[model samples]
Target: MDVDTRHWIGGRRVANADTFEDVSPLDGEVIAVVSRGGTAEVDAAVAAAKDAFVGWSRTSPAERAELLRRVAAGIEARIEDLAQVETRDNGSLLRSHRRGVMPRVAMNIRFFADHLSSLVHSDFDTRGHRNHVTWDPAGVTAIVTPWNAPLMLATWRIGPALAAGNTVVAKPPEWAPLTASLFADIAHEAGLPAGVFNVVQGLGNEAGAPLVAHPDVRRICFTGSVPTSIKVGESAARNVTPVSFELGGKSPLLVFDDADLDLAVDLAVEQFDNSGQVCLAAVRMLVQDGIYDEFRARFLERAATLVQGDSRDEGVDLGPLVSKSHFERVDGFVKRAVAGGAEVILGGGPNDELNVATGGFYYRPTVFEGVDRTMEITCQEVFGPVLTLQGFSTEDDGIAMANDTDYGLAATIVTGSQERAERVASAVRAGTVWVNCFFVRDLSAPFGGSGRSGIGREGGTWSFDFYCDVKNSVFAPKGWN
Candidate 1:
């Protein structure tokens, strides 16, 4: 796997002496030696973006749209290689990358490209005068993406930022830095002008802090934990720079007694999608007391059947926990839960024998049966394949228990009654609430969180609103003055 793992600045791979190991969670192997950036690298990348912003911001929406289409094509052409390296880099299932992740990268770019072309501003006549409102491109945008589905999330922010005619400097997660280098290559090859999109690869403090705090950066977009987002917000505030964050969650999934049991059970299993490394997955499940016993029985049976091993395996459903430290963190949460009297119905921790056999950072798909809202496993955002269950006697109790958490990112509702579905969806304190299915995404819809989960919404017009400055110019009528 010989590849150019360096900072991408000014349409090329820039070199740096400070480097870090891109370790594989699959088997704890050093996949690549990547350049670790600092304040100097951040300054250089920001300067490059600042230089390109002047020209890029003045381009027509049609021009920006066409270039983005080319970027989407570049991703589609090399989707398989991109998917493979991503699986190798961060321990996500290869099947998911091929099926969803890489394809969505292309989709994210194409959707925003088309959106830019169709975008329309507003104009009105008021008091014998004409007022025209326009979406003006903000200058340089600083984007810091998380490791889980790194490329897809980056493009989710990147597509709109570029479509709105803003230049970008991104700090891809150091845990999975490979694909971002490849993404910058795709952007450059797609005829994106030099410095329009730059990459500074390093840790949160070394590179990420400097990029977000850079005085020249106009807007900041970040996706990761809530604690980190607070620091970002604080840094961005010093310059009064606007920031958009999509942070962590311990979102709830409400299952009513009237719900279809089979569908309910399957949805519970789907929480482990991407090995439960998903932020929106409902790890905290609150079930109506009527169906609690049956749902728990069926859920544990299905959870036990899930295969955990090599992410490259076609039959596997779960993989390693992304890193040794992350594995430890998730395991620590479970240990505390067990210590506090929460019964682990399935998967307390990793199987040491199997872990030694594969040399992979693996954890069993865990479910806690007796966890209350006070338990760490029930309230905290365990970004691993962990589930916590509690029973509620009535609809009010279920919704109340669901909203008890500090996070309000997303939620899932399961019920057979239409009235109940509508009422519960409205009552649930989350940004996005799913009534029946899970992970069904619409590109045009506003996507983000509430409370400690996130700061703003993005997707389609919402993205444009955040990435661009909406301005209005008023003029007197020809004879009015």
Candidate 2:
């Protein structure tokens, strides 16, 4: 593990001529050096996938399903190892990865694999002709994952794409590429065919641009920031290749006066569990006037109890942000918000009490008040453990404030009244709405956003459709032609 991390291409470990340091944000140390794959590596991966596509696509559904099941089992067996690597590489709390992320990864793969048997074709009979509708693999697909949840998110694309019988060439974010290598190992152990799945680790501009723009790649699925996704889309557009995006969000968490205050406070504090680096984190809170003050008090009290330190610490609840650059970015956002008259009700900067020798990129969970809807901090994505509080007088006002952002990835409503919950959930313009909870997800449900959040969905049947192309065949009896 201490050696340089190489690319997993064409069913083997391939080393590049150049390498880059894989720094750990927790200790600000070079944990490992990873291959800096570029156009040549991307080309090799795509070519390998193309060469494997015909045979992989021709594999029976049962065979593919079995392979997927084996992969799932392999992931389960190596859950601890995968979780440790992810936590070390991404600066996520080890407990969070062990209990939350790793299990979800295995479940996501199995969920898609189990559904393969039910993937059926359709038939239609006319007066003189019989027509059939079938789903075919979209050849080779390029999957680009973000640094936040490398393995989990990549599996969101990889599981379904492989289940649909398409070969894959994946590019894990340069920041956290360790678990991706582990995932490739598990896939090979599960008896996946050579060239069916590949991983190229490097910077986005160097490796990602060429992969998306490659003429041989039929589809692209990317999870990252809005700007990066736009660039990915433009590249895919040139070749007329389809692309699916799960982009940024400034998600709102609505706390009605009638909501359970304790639960609201607990969930709000939970936002800092991953230091608020999640795309679906409830970064904005719209509380009713009656409960705004009390909610803010309880939220700050709870957030204060969270322990911030190195991700490897078992007692820590909030770990450092992913990298030094991300730490500076989050710090800058807080500074700007304060300058705009927003009050730092709880935390405003890094936690100095933690051992400095850790050298981690730590940021205390910050809570801000008096934030206006038009302010940059309110409308833009900070992608940090910073929450902006706004009070709403009416239900309409709350809904308006929630949908004010350009991004509509996800939102949550914490209300005791069933009618209010139903009404507000319908009114909010987000892809996923949690009625009484935050970050609750089901693999069967569609997950994506509207208006800059993302381009398409990535769960259950939606995933199946995105990874496959449909074809219609007709048969005429006698002289029907």
Candidate 3:
């Protein structure tokens, strides 16, 4: 297949000899071809960012915030176009991406922009003392985003970094570079300085590693898998460069005996939104034995009711996996779970009925029954719309089971008692615990994982602290000195 080599560099589309194909998962069709960048592309992007950083980082915070506001406007203006492209590119349901994801992300950008405009730096009132603490830019950041929710997560990192006066050489996943390019274009149109935000498109081994390890690159903000995050950590360690990783999760949903079974079932189904591709999605559903069967039956009924169809189709609740490899991996996990003796309580296997003429990569929304905490299906971050339902004998057992995973990204607890919700939420051992909902994220909330899930937070005002550094100066006043 002939591939197009259009790479986003310094806010413009450039071409090169190398290329990669953008394949559609809806029918395994070649949608477009993207440039496969290499060391040269990485070096160019970094050099541009480094050259621009001196001036861009020195820009007034209000000016930076204004630029972000314009970018947000640009995004809103092209929301439909972006939503359609994202749906076609990633197999995300168009309605969900438009109604749920894009609007939320755009709102986040505006929220942060307004916050940045209103921000006032600390004042030193130490009786004429020169000693004070100051926050400073960390230079250029390498913002690497995953293929899943490419634009939203990228802006989550880039927005704060820019707001903190850090220029960026952003690199989207080669497999999904168009959205990154679109964002960069929007930023440029918003009157951002030339070279302030550079984007590179290429594979991880070639473009991504070099960008992370580049001496001029100050901090690396990455959102991807835990294993890949470790590799990034290794590279960052070698250079002593700071890194903030938003990685994997096997998040759990714990339903207490006194919980509203109907609402629990509703929230449990929400866990599978976006086909459970989110890193913070609740993949494990743990119910107290008293209500396990009831919750299980309700949850499966809800799951079965999901309308699996093309993303562009109206009223389609689910869509195909992001790619062929993703489909295969998800299929493998479901098959392996059955092989490992977990019973399929509801929908399982592939869905050819949704798009019979088209070879859509659709996996049936699956639920595994009789799952134990130690089972692979329960412990692994499957990253699919597959939930493993397990029953716990006691509240303590439920909490223990929820916390048993290596991940501590997010967890959900369903209970009517405020005290029980608070206690269980606190004891769940996850970074963010939803008392009665699942995946309710906000701009002001600090979002990140603990343990093996991830390294740093990515939202709210707290995220700004992650992209910059603070220096404390201790000294007496001139008279005292």
- lDDT (CA) per prediction: 0.92, 0.89, 0.81
Question: In lDDT terms, which candidate is top?
Answer: 1
Ranking by TM-score: 1, 2, 3
Tell me which residue pairs clash in candidate 3.
none
* lDDT of prediction 2: 0.89
Candidate 3, position 91, lDDT:
85
Q: Local error of candidate 3 at 342, Å?
A: 0.9
Candidate rank order under lDDT:
1, 2, 3
lDDT of 1 by residue, 1-481 (tens): 5568989998888989999999988888999999999999999999999999999999889999999999999999989989999999999999999989999999999999999865786678899788998889998999999998999999999999999999999999989989999999888899999999999999999999999999999999999998999999999999999999999898888999999999999999999987788999999888899999999899888888998889999999988988888899999998999999999888888867668987889999888888777777887898998888889999999999989988889999999999999999999899899998899888999999999999889988999999999988998878553
Q: In model 3, where is the ten-residue run with the lowest total lDDT?
A: 1-10
The residue-by-residue lDDT of candidate 2 on 124-243, one tens digit each, is 889868888777899999999999999999998999999999999999998999998888999998999999999999999999999999999999999999999889999999999999
* Candidate scoring better on TM-score of 1 and 2: 1
TM-score of 2: 0.97
Indicate the TM-score of model 1: 0.98
Candidate 3 per-residue lDDT over residues 109-228, each given as its tens digit: 787777675444565656665556555678889989998889888888777888888888887876566777777767777888887888888889988989888888889998888888
TM-score of each: 0.98, 0.97, 0.95
Candidate 2 backbone collisions, by pair: none
lDDT of 3: 0.81
Output the number of the TM-score-best candidate. Answer: 1
